[model samples]
Target chain A: MAAVDWGTTRLRVWLVDEAGNVLAERRGDDGLITAQAAGFSTILEGHLAAMGAPEAMPVIVCGMAGSRQGWLEAPYVTVPAPIGAILAGAARVPGQRRDIRIVPGLAQRQADAPDVMRGEETQLAGAGLPAKGRHLVCMPGTHSKWVLVEDSAVTGFGTWPTGELFSVLAAHSILRHSLGEQPQPVASGNPFFQRWCEQALAEGGDVTSRLFSIRAAGLLQDLKPGDAAACLSGLLIGGEIASASRRYGKGGSVVLVASGALSTLYTEALGLAGLAVRAVDADEAVRAGLIEAARKNGMIAGSGVAA
Target chain B: MAAVDWGTTRLRVWLVDEAGNVLAERRGDDGLITAQAAGFSTILEGHLAAMGAPEAMPVIVCGMAGSRQGWLEAPYVTVPAPIGAILAGAARVPGQRRDIRIVPGLAQRQADAPDVMRGEETQLAGAGLPAKGRHLVCMPGTHSKWVLVEDSAVTGFGTWPTGELFSVLAAHSILRHSLGEQPQPVASGNPFFQRWCEQALAEGGDVTSRLFSIRAAGLLQDLKPGDAAACLSGLLIGGEIASASRRYGKGGSVVLVASGALSTLYTEALGLAGLAVRAVDADEAVRAGLIEAARKNGMIAGSGVAA
Candidate 1:
């Protein structure tokens, strides 16, 4: 069996043995945006061939590939929904050479606070839902998701455009003058980043006002470009945590599903925000989720009965 | 005499008679950013000549023209300081054909909440500081200033990057997909705008999270381009007002120093937030500010003592 996490800008695939051990893996730039124009089936076949996967191997997919503009629309499953239900509601690609199932995303249709998530749902499932007590999950990315899980069900969730906002402001806004043209990675241990995180957490609600302080600090206090970049990251991540904590209720421990640089930054920020976080590798979680979905759909042999 | 508002992206010069009445006006794209390389003196001279001003006319300039990168660094007048003191601290351009004075901006030097504003001080001086009472002034622009004025002095203020955020998000972020290429002015009475404004005011502090909803709403509810644009505007403005009101204390009536479309949008949003707003034309206020600065500096004859 094979698993794939296909998003807007990147694609990751893994070939797994019957016991769910990863035998091989491959990554590509052929995300939904690129693959949509140049055939999804072709892209998937090429990637599978590159990984040397068998032609009859069953594949499980997640993320934007199931979006309306992708190969086929996998309509959103509304919350308070069980994570396992996503696998049960998976949409299979029609007229395919092999069995390919795409996990459905989640939607919060509350009129006042409507939100949707594509790839993060799989991350949540892979993180393992809390069985007895409620849990708060923070998945940081281009669109960060704050999920509330109670007794293995996702009660509600919110999305924060922190990453996107930071990118756009750092590149396009006047703050770009302070933050140089090149995208510099903010160091998690930078004091400037820590100070800004504390400041943002303290001034929780006034993000817009605090954002201007970056420029003011740059202009008036001679804040260095690298520090400015770190400050920006801290402020955005800290503010997201503050707001998410408030909105979702900060009662339980937060499960942070992330990887690489983002994971480090978010872990530091959550710690600064004074929350205990259980870290999970996002890549592994997504793959585990795909494997679980495949097993539930009977595309792969498993003893578990439809989750 | 002439009054000039030389900002980063625009230049506006108004020829005024001794009685403080505008005789002629000229506007150009050569702001401090553009004029810095093009020669500030040459640009000013051309505008003055276009407005048919006399060679000996003393010009009172405000805004970015006073920045370090401007004609000459006017330096910052620290607060809690009187607005009229700006005239006294003005930086004069030496070795020029005409007497050109640039009013200094105000800076809050506090290490925790450092903030700075250039042109708005002149507007405050022109608007005539509240006599024997406290006033909250909202100057909406690229960097909107929410100033707290008491007994003719600016005690403290905050800057919200609402306008810049809106522009960047509308033009560069994922929201741009729904908002089209050309920026559309949000209608004040748009229901989507009003609803989002009310929601933002209610939610108040979660701007980053709410921003993502704009994209989600567009995706799930099929929100149109115009409505999406309006919704974005409402969320930003409402969030700004909410945070500003909280930080500045929502006791006094808000003095909305804005003009045209922004004024209308702000006024309506403020009204929705259940705050009484005293609308002051921003153009007239800035002009009056420049005129007052000129008079106080003894460049023009006036009987009125500096407020």
Candidate 2:
């Protein structure tokens, strides 16, 4: 069984033998912006050519590459379903010369607060428990998703444009006057950040107003440039925390699907919002979900489902 | 006396003849960015060339062009007064043959709000007053300023970076994702804009959340992109109006310093704020202020100040 998680910026392909044992894996750029989708075909071909060809090898793919703009349009599955219901929802990707299947992205409520899952459904199936829970799975990125899992079913979820806002404001806003150009990691105990958090918590001030303080702080010697950028970062993330708390916040076992250094920052913010943090490997979840999808569809040997 | 108003992006030099006439004028690229004092040589030379003069002229200069980065490092005069106490502040470009004088900017701190103004002092001086009634001046631009005029002097002011913020978000933010790359005018009285206004008024609702709605509104068939853009503009301006009300609402006489299209927008927003819109010609204000500054220093002959 082979599962591929192809996201905007990165691509990872995993291979499992008949026993579901991980035999090999490869990672490459899947962002497709520069390499185009040609890169994905080349990587898969190289690995298959090196591993020696099997009689039949079925592949399951997911992520942006599955969208209308991706390698092919993968039909989206609506929300509120048991584990197996949506698997039947994926549209087949008719690769010209390769046996390939793509996972469908999900959308709800006309895309306002739409939640999406590219290749993560297989992992949910493997979790075994009913998707039913007051469960909220947070996948943070340029567009952060908060998926509500209930009774082994994919219920409603909210997608906040928080990540994109942070990216643009940090890199492009006039706050850059004080922040300079590059991003600087924020100190954990910075007073400016503390002021930002407390002030936002107390007054729920507009983020724009809060951002202006970066320039003001620098001018008043209240904050240095690096610290000003960090403080702005804190303000943005802190606002995200506050916003998410109110949006996808109802009861549930909160799951944070995070990667890299951002995990700690997000966890800390969640804690600040009084949320108990439990981390999940986002890569593993999506990878696992894709594998189960392949096995369930009989594209891979059923005995290899455990892989 | 000759006065130069050096702004951030452009160097504006007016030749206030001894009779207080703009005998000749010249403009050049930003005086600050070029590292050369356009305020001194090129501008003076241009004026001299235009008027066919070989003698030096006394001038008064203001704006960012006169700041530390400008041709002259004009000191920031504190508020509640019309003119800086210092003599032309620090002249960076002391031309060997030109008798040039630069007007200083203003810096003020009132309780917790601190503000710095450049080039506006010229207008305040031109608006000769009894020093008792309040005059609220709203200067809308990349970084909008709402100045509180008290007794002929600027008591304090609050800065709302609505223009810059709008520009950055519309051009760079994730909001750009939903909007096509093409630039378009915003639709007035559009539903998207109305939604933005509602969001702006929402308790704790930040602009970031409303930003994504641009895409959502346009993509989902309910809102036009132009209208979505307009809503964003409206939301930002609305938010600014709210902030300004809190900071400088004590005034009975509110004055708006804008002209042309921006003036109309500002007028619409002021109407939304339930304030009587009184438009002041910005160019005339600058001229009046320059003339008054020249007259006060006995450099030019007439009052020539208009309200």
Candidate 3:
């Protein structure tokens, strides 16, 4: 019995019987970056031993570790490449002790355009939700990925590091002094926040004048630091959404893969845009994706699979 | 006689006699970032010795080196802080046998709306050629500084790291593949460039959709990488200028302190906004700022007095 999901920062594993009954499971800090540096076998050995899984256990690996820079370079499925095709192309870890297979990524090139994505390939396939129409999927994070899916395939997609930029700006800019240690305000549609977004959107935002407003409103006008940071967050996220709409907006369906406060923030903001937002649980999607990958590789029965 | 201009990147010393006649000069790489780590005296020694100047020679400094992180921390001059004031508040390097004075920067504030500047003080002094009405001076670079002044006194200002942002986005993002090199083909005002900017401004980009265009335009539509990069540059700079107008656009003046391609770029863009443009040589301004600073502190002669 085996289950595993690997990302840039965390390593997760699960113990399951042939009937997919979870008797035990374990987790550790075996990320792709570390696994690449420390032998993947050694790290996996420590964790598997903890889970009481034997060396001969069959395990499925996904995420960043499946990339070229990963422990074992999994091949990429080019853009316009089908999700099912990528799942079928999973790479097997060449070791006699353990049965491990790494899922391949996806890529596409049409006309002169080209893009490639790795782990998302499996997640999109495992979504278990049928794709009958055009789908606009927004995956928010450091490098936020927005994908367009049609005919159960990833036709094309774009990525934005909205999360990374937001983090950096919040920490480094003048806004930092005002926004010190406060949680991002909960009011997604706060008036000051909307106004700030409109102001930046209006300026095409070389972002100079409106930025001074951040300091001015705080120093003279007495705008709260949390509100100011929230306002700035609004501008950045708003700017990103505005820029992205040009592409994926053409799609008729919208699904947002997010969780926690971020999901609330994005969904509330999107509500303002008059779009019906369907929020997906991030953790569930990760598991659903892994299970589907294992089934496609013949490691599990596709019939009545449970995640 | 001594004349030197220390900018962010290069150290240029003009060895001169009392008449401002050149005896000999030397050039070296000693931007603030580099000098911040290697002590200021080491950076100064190389130049002074190169010019055959004695350790006791009185050398004045201006620009960023006079900032808090510079060779010595020259204090910040508050808004409405005049050019002469910065010189008067110059900070001297201690322990060196040589007499050294660093010019102070300018500042602006409205109640708690306080912002300060350093290098532009000298640029305005050097451009002493005109101050007829309200004018706007823009110094474009990694951190492009826009200084608004009236009757020769700095009124208010803002900073836009357009160049720096452009550098980071183009060099780091997937967009980098398209932005082959600088001086890209898509001029800021071109139809495609304008459309891209307008869309981003109007729509409020989504991370996925906003960034996807770079790949899409190049991948799906067959747009060139350089042109793509240029379009991105135009969008950012245009957005910045647009943002700046909202704050400082209310009937003042316009001047620019920059050189090379950057100056031309900002000048053309700002021209699109109908603001009058003029430029002050950063190198010369640093020299003049230094001289002015020395005199304010009794290091150099007053206007009529000789060294």
- Number of the top-ranking candidate, with DockQ as the measure: 1
- Superposition TM-score, candidate 1 onto the true structure: 0.97
DockQ of each: 0.76, 0.29, 0.20
CAPRI class assigned to model 3: incorrect
In angstroms, give how far residue A83 of model 1 lies from its true place.
Answer: 1.6
Which candidate should be chosen as best, given TM-score against the real structure? 1
Q: Write the per-residue lDDT of candidate 2 for residues A1-307, one digit (tens) a residue.
A: 6677777777777787655567878887645453364655676666666666463677777777776557777766777766665664555665536568776766554444424555555555544443345677766777666666777677776555666766676677666677777767666666666656655544344566555656655655455677776676667766765655566653335678777766766776666656787887676676667766776666766633321
lDDT of 1 by residue, A133-175 (tens): 8888899998889988888889999998889888999999988
- Model 1 residue B48 CA deviation (Å) reads 1.7
> Which lDDT tens digits does candidate 3 get at residues A146-264?
78888777778766667755665566555566677754655756776676555444433234344445654664456787787777766666655554565555224468887787787
Tell me how far the alpha carbon of residue B60 in candidate 1 is from the true structure, in angstroms, after superposition. Answer: 1.2
Q: Clashing residue pairs, candidate 1? A: none
Give the per-residue Cα lDDT of candidate 1 at A134. Answer: 83
List iRMS for all predictions. 1.3, 3.4, 5.8
lDDT of 2 by residue, B51-168 (tens): 5655656566667766665665667766666342322243435645655556777665442344566776666555444456777888787777777766655677667778887777
lDDT of 3 by residue, B1-307 (tens): 4666676787777665444456777877888878988877888888788778976678877777876667777767777755555567767778988777776676565542345556767766666546457677677766667777776677777766566556666655556766765536444356555545554333322222445456556744577776777667666656666556656753344666776666666666666555676666666655665555566677655662212
Error of 2 at A252 (Å): 9.6
